[model samples]
Target: MGISRHATAHWEGDLKTGKGRLSTPDSGLMQDTRYAFSSRFGDEKGTNPEELIAAAHAGCFTMALSAKLAEAGHPPARLDTRADVDLSMEDGPALSRIRLKLDAEVPGIDEARFQEIANDAKENCPVSKALSAVPITLEAKLKR
Candidate 1:
């Protein structure tokens, strides 16, 4: 379980009135980074850490679900997962909640069984384990 990402930031002033750029490893895009309470809440085009976390969670959950399906002998023909992370200022820089949606096309599984597998995937996914402080909701659909 080894993964790495790097970002460099430069700030000239205090947190409320400062701005920075966040970039991934080898990414060419200079994303705008600032305090959420500033004038950059949902207006700036750049992404924040919560969005990145959501992306990772989505990918991780999809892979976990795929593995679960295959392990159950009903491998999915296709699986699409999307995760939405909401950020709030209750305590600190923490994820308020996460919503996950999964659409899959697999053979030889009923909706109930598919849902069971999806629940298992959600509980066992790595990202989910890492984000145990946040509540996650799942909506799974089986394509007929």
Candidate 2:
């Protein structure tokens, strides 16, 4: 069977004034973390769905890149990835695009080869595959 993970959201009251708590029991990384309309759409301090998605995408992409590099015999010394999830209300509130910015330090790998690997990871990563409906862009930099 394929791997499965789960998180739960507990919301109270109406949308505008309601508050919610998100919890990931398995990892315990998020325990009753607060999220609300203000935190999502306004300047309130809390977690939001887009931010969570970005975090997941960034983490997945980074690990995928590492794997790709290792498979290519150019294991990375370090890799940093940032995913930006854009949420817009065109027809409705939808995830319009995702941008992945990756900075990698690999010994003996050229820029062209690094770019190729980064592109491959961006296209083949699990998270990228899962979010295939959204437009995904990548900016990769190889550092010496």
Each model's backbone clash number? 0, 0
lDDT of every predicted structure (CA atoms): 0.82, 0.94
lDDT of 2 at 30: 98
lDDT of 2 by residue, 72-112 (tens): 99999999888999999889899999999987899989999
**What is every candidate's alpha-carbon RMSD to the true fold?**
3.0, 0.8
For model 2, the stretches where C-alpha displacement exceeds 4 angstroms are none
* Model 1 pairs in collision: none
TM-score of 1: 0.80
Clashing pairs in 2: none
